[model samples]
Target: MDILAKERKLLELEKQVEALGNNEAVNKLKSEIEKYKHNEMTKLTAWDRVLLARHQKRPTALDFINYMSPDFIELHGDRLYSDDKSIVGGIGSINGVPFTIVAQQKGKDLENNLERNFAMPHPEGYRKALRLMEQAEKFKRPIITIIDTPGAYPGIGAEERGQGHAIAQNLLKMSEFSVPIISVVIGEGGSGGALALGVANKVLMLENAIYSILSPEGYASILWKDASLAPKAAEVMKLTAYDLEEFEIIDGIIKEPLGGAHYDKRETFKRTKQAIITEYNKLRRLSGTELQYRRTSKIRKFGFFQRFNYDNLGGIKR
Candidate 1:
């Protein structure tokens, strides 16, 4: 069974055991549940981690912002177009350190999802994020970005507004920013939508999160002409945090609570907060020139590969 299905069955069993009013049975079932969780979490597949990252009850960007910075002041508008609700940018302080926080916000329910376009941002959303980061740079505050998006909106209206240009601008400006930039992948980090805000001195991902150029379904559809083979595609995509860390695509992984972040949100948030702080502490010590150099160097090294000689078998080189 899938992770969600197993979790549902476990919940139902726990409820039934509690309803029986036998303390001994209840205690025994709880212990078994804990054991099950431990075993399952240890062997999660890439697709399993995808499900956990996109869990309905998973903590959203606003949730993390509120928990980490109670006094956050939200800023809106791109100054060039209308404010896009899918992207939320603001100024906040975490542990007394000021930061400009930009996050892609997903709705918790149907209505809210419709309103936020299911976290699929438009060109204006990227512009808004760029504006906030520019402001942060001016004020000499660190910038923190929370990424969780399937991709940028592909609608005609979004394209009419120069969607690609907006994303490109953010990447170029972010690379040159003097202030420290740290990006955390909290969920579905897909396509340029995620990368638009992902140019950072240090990139991190939650243990269960997945970061990829595109979704597994999309990859499967393109390669095999069947979206149903997404699970198989996930195995080949190398999108999991562990895989990305091994590839040096991400700087570190923040451990999630057992089962997923939704299972223990408070603990998850606490760990995420600590990870951000730790990374920031290291970045803060560097000068503006050093920060820029570090960020550009990191970006330049992406997709690097070692050359191999193959002239022994055939006079061909790859």
Candidate 2:
């Protein structure tokens, strides 16, 4: 059975045990359920982590922002276009240290998701994020970006508004920012939408989060002509936190609760807050020049590859 199916079965048993109240059998049943849960969690595959990352109850960017900075005040608009609800930016403080916070905000349900455009940003969203980051640099406050988007919006309106240009501008500006910046991938970090806010001194991802150029289903559809093979595609894509960390693409990984972040949001928030603060403390010691240099240096090192001679294999020579 799948993880959710097993969880449902366990829930049913717990309900039955509750009816029998104060008995040794109930205690024994509870212990078995706990054991089962632990074993299943330990055996999770990459696809399972993907599902967990996209879990409905998983805490969103705003949830983490509010937990880390109770006094967070949201700012709106790209100053040129209307406000894009998909991306949120503002000022907040963590442990008395002020920061400019930017994040992709996903809604809790269908209605809210529609309002947020399913967290798929438009051109204005990236522009708003850039505006906020520029302000952060001017004020000398560290910037924290929470990434959790499948990708940027690809609708006709977004394209007409220059979605690609907006994302590219953010990338160019972020690399030159003279303030400390840290980005965290809390869930699905797909394509340039995520990378637009991801050029940071330190990049981190939750244990279960996935980051890649595209979604596994999209990859499967393009490569194998079958979207149903997403599970297999996930394995080959290596989009998991451990995989990215192994490749040295991500700086660090924050631990999640047993099942997922949604299982224990308070613990998840605590760990995320601690991780961000710890990374920021380290980056805070460096000068603005050093910070920009390190960030750009890190970006330049991506996509390293070795060249081989095709003549040796009886193939066309370069």
TM-score per candidate, in order? 0.97, 0.95
Q: What is the C-alpha local distance difference test score of candidate 2?
A: 0.94
Worst 10 residues of 1 by lDDT: 17-26
> Whole-model Cα lDDT per candidate?
0.93, 0.94
lDDT comparing candidate 1 with the true structure: 0.93
Residue lDDT tens for model 2, 1-318: 655666578779779878888778788878988998889877878888888888898999999999999999999999998999999999999999999999999999999999999899999999999999999999899999999999999999999999999999999999999999999999999999999999999999999999999999999999999999998999999999999998889999999998889889999999999999999989999999999999999999998856677998999876
For candidate 1, lDDT tens digit of each residue in 64-124?
9999999999999999989999999999999999999999999999999999999999999
In model 2, pairs of residues that clash are none
Query: Considering summed lDDT, which 10 consecutive residues are worst modelled in model 2?
Result: 1-10
